[model samples]
Target: MACLSKSSTFSKTFGLRNLLNLTHLLKIIHRMFYK
Candidate 1:
């Protein structure tokens, strides 16, 4: 049970990190196109 909870927390953080990275990538793309 403890392992399952730990994995869930890790997945949540990993998902959040991926979302941040995607936002950063989109900003870069927008800048490149606008510039």
Candidate 2:
């Protein structure tokens, strides 16, 4: 049970990291187009 929770937590953190990376990429793209 403990291992399960740890895996779940790790998955959530990884998902957030991916989302942040995606957001950063989008911002870069938007700046390039606007500029």
Candidate 3:
């Protein structure tokens, strides 16, 4: 039970990090296109 909770928490954090990285990538693409 404890391990399951820990893995869930880790997955959530990893997902958030991926989202943030994707957002940053999109922003860079937008800027390149605008320029």
Distance from true location, Cα of 22 in model 1, Å:
0.1
Off by over 4 Å in 1: none
lDDT of 2 at 22: 100
lDDT of 2 at 11: 100
Q: lDDT tens string, model 2, 1-35?
A: 99999999999999999999999999999999999
Instruction: State candidate 3's TM-score.
Output: 0.94
Query: What TM-score would candidate 1 get against the native?
Result: 0.98
TM-score of each candidate structure, all chains considered together: 0.98, 0.87, 0.94
* Candidate 2: segments with Cα more than 4 A from true spot: none
Worst 10 residues of 1 by lDDT: 26-35
C-alpha lDDT of all candidate models, in order: 1.00, 1.00, 1.00
- Give the clashing pairs for model 2: none
Between candidates 1 and 2, name the one with more favorable TM-score. Answer: 1
Off by over 4 Å in 3: none
